[model samples]
Target: MTVSSGSPLAPKVVRGAFVRLDEIGIGVVPQVIAFQYNPETLTRKLKPYEQPADKQGTPQDPAARAAPYDPEEEMDVAIAFDAMDDLAEPDRHPQTVISGVADRISALEMLMYPPATPSLLTSAVGALAGALGIGGGADPVPTTTEVPIVLFVWGPGRIVPVKITTFSVEEQAFNSALYPIRAKVTVGIRVLTADYFTSKLTEKGARLTAAESIAATAYRAAVEQKKVLAAVGVASTVESVLATLPF
Candidate 1:
C-alpha cells in the first residue's frame, strides 16, 4: 500500500484530536493484520485502614462495598509489509536491499520512544549549582518531552488513543545476497483511557474523551455478553456435560 500524500489510498485526514503516525512518512504503507483488542477492568477495594469490630467480633461495615466499573479497552495489531522492493530495480536506488529494511525498522523503533527525560547527572548538577549559589548563572539544560499519543483508527468507533507497548519483527525470507525481502512486525498497543491526556482530548468532534471511552467499553462488553448468552443453549462445554441427558 502507498501512503504518500500523492498516493490515491492515502489515509483520510480526520479533524479533531487524531494523531498522525509514521511521521517520517514511509514511502509504502504496511499491510496491517492480526489486529486484536483487549479490554480490562480495574477497581479499588474499600476496607478502611482498620475495620471496626462489633460486639460479636465480626466487622461492622459490610454494606459499604461497591460494584466494579465496566472494563477498559486496549488493542494489539501487526503490520506486515515488504521492504526494499527497490532491490528488484537496483538502478533505482543506490542502497543495498538489506539496508532498506533495516532503515524502515529503525524508524519504527524511533516512533515508540518517549522523548528523553532529565538524567540523574543533570539533576545532580542542578542541585550542586543551587548549593554553590550559582544556579542562576548556570546555563539552562534541555529536557525531553513526551511523544505525541497515537490514534488507532480502524473505523468509526474503533478509534482510540494508544500507547505502543511492544514491537516485534520477524524477517521471513532473504535473497541470495542475504538481503531481507519479506518481514512482519507485530506490535502490542494499549488503548489510553479517557482520563489519559485529559488536557488534550475532548468530545466536541472526533477527539475521544473519558465519557466516550466509558461508553465504548460498555458497548464492547454488551456485545461479548450477547455472544456468551447465545452459546448457553447452542454451545457445549464442561457445564453441558454435567447437565446433558442420559446416554
Candidate 2:
C-alpha cells in the first residue's frame, strides 16, 4: 500500500525519503528526495554473523572467540516514476515537456558517482603556478574521493545509513529528447551497521565518509528499535505455536 493509504480521518501520513548527509551528520541542501508514492512491497534479507565450529580457522576456545555481531541486512524495492502530474503544471514544470524523467533519473544516478571536482582550468592554473616555483610542486587535490552518507528513512522506526549495492532503471515512454516519461527503477541496498566504516568492514576500493560520524547515533537507535520489535514477537509466537500443537 502507498504511504498515504488509510482512513480519510486518520492522522497525517509519513512519506519515505532518502536523506543525504555530509561527512559529519549535517544535512545536504537540495539533496533530499521524498517518494511521490510508496512501493507496493519491500523485501528484506538478513544473514546472521555466525561462525561454524567445523570451519578450519574458527576459534576453538569459546572464551577466545569474538563476541557475536549484528546480522548483515539488505533491502530491495521498486520505485515508480511518472511525469504526468508534474506535466499538468506547465509553468512550474515546463522542462517535463522536453526532458521528461531525465531530471528525476539523474538525481538517483548521481549517487553512484563521485562529486564533481575542481574544473580543468582551475587545475591547469594550479599546475602552472607550481611550474613557475610560486608554490609547492605538489598540486595535491585528493586523488581519492569519499562519498557522502545516504540514509533510508521509513517512518520513525528505520533511519539507517546504507550503501547502494544495485540499481537498475527501465524506461518506458519517452519524449522527443529521448528522456523517459514513465519508468520503473529497482534499487538494492546494504544497511551499514555499527561495525561498518572506512578501514572496517567494507567492499574493496569502496569508501564512505561515515567514518566522520555522520548519523552514527541514528544507526544505533534503529538497531535497538529492531531488537525491541523482535522482543515483542515472543507472545504472538507462543500463541501461534500452542494453537498449531493443540496445546
Candidate 3:
C-alpha cells in the first residue's frame, strides 16, 4: 500500500495489515560504544609523523630519526546495554504485537471508504502522522521534505518491500556538558514486524504469511548498521519532541 504526502502525519505513517509470523527473543551482548569515526582525527594524528626535509641532501640526524612518536589519543565512548531481565514481565511477544497493530490499522482503513484503493494507505499514514504531530499546521508544507517509514510485508510465498517517505519537523536541545545542541527531535512513524515459518507436508519449503513477508523485508533493511542507527536516531528525536509537547 502507498501513502500520500499531503497528510500531516504522512511523515510518520506506517500502514499495512500484518499477521503473526514468529516471535523469538535473542540475547544482545554488551559491546564497546564507538562514535562515528572522524577521518580528520586520523589525518591530524598522522601529520606529525611525516619525515623532515633533508636540507643537506645527506643522511638525516640519528637523534631526529630516533625520536619517539607520540601515540594517537583514543576517545573513550560511553555505552551501556539494558539488562534483558529489565524488560516487561511475561515478555511482550514481538510477533503478536506487530500483528495486533497491523490488524487495527487495516480495520481502520476499511472504514474510510466504500471501496478501498491503495491511496487509502496514504490516509492511514496521515492518521498516524497527525497523531505524531507531523505537518498539518498553518505553514505551507515543503514538497521536498522526506520522512523515512519502514514497512514489513508478509505473503504466502515471498516477501514484498515498500518504503514510504514524507516530511516532518526537527527540533534541538542543549547539552551543558558537551555542546549546545546535544539532542534533537523528529516526528515519524516506525513499522516493525515479526514473521514465523511454517512447513507444509506437500512442499519442501515453508509457507509465509502476508505479514511475515513485509516484516522480513523491513528486517533486511534494519540489518544494515547505518539504517539501524538512522532509525534509532529518529526514534530518539521523536521521543524528545513528545516529552516537550504541551498537552
lDDT of each: 0.49, 0.71, 0.32
- For candidate 3, give the lDDT of residue 223: 43
- State the RMSD for candidate 2: 7.7
Candidate 2 residues lying further than 4 Å off, grouped into runs, are: 1-10, 23-30, 52-67, 116-143, 198-212, 235-247
Expressed as tens digits, the lDDT of each residue in 115-196 for candidate 3 is: 2222343445555556666645222221322221223232222122223222222223222332222211111222322322
Off by over 4 Å in 3: 1-106, 109-205, 209-211, 225-247
TM-score of 1: 0.42
Give the candidate number with the greatest lDDT.
2
Q: Is candidate 2 or candidate 3 better by lDDT?
A: 2
The total of clashing pairs for model 1 equals 0
lDDT per residue for candidate 2 within 89-182, as digits (tens), equals: 9689888888888787777776676545633644665676677765574553344475556888888899888888999999999877789999
Q: List the residue pairs that clash in candidate 1.
A: none
Put down candidate 1 lDDT per residue, 127-227, tens digits, no spaces: 66666666463433444465534555544434555666778988887767665566766667666544444424554555643334443453454446657
Ranking by lDDT: 2, 1, 3
TM-score of predicted structure 2: 0.70
For each of the candidates, the C-alpha root-mean-square deviation to the true structure, in angstroms, is 14.2, 7.7, 25.4
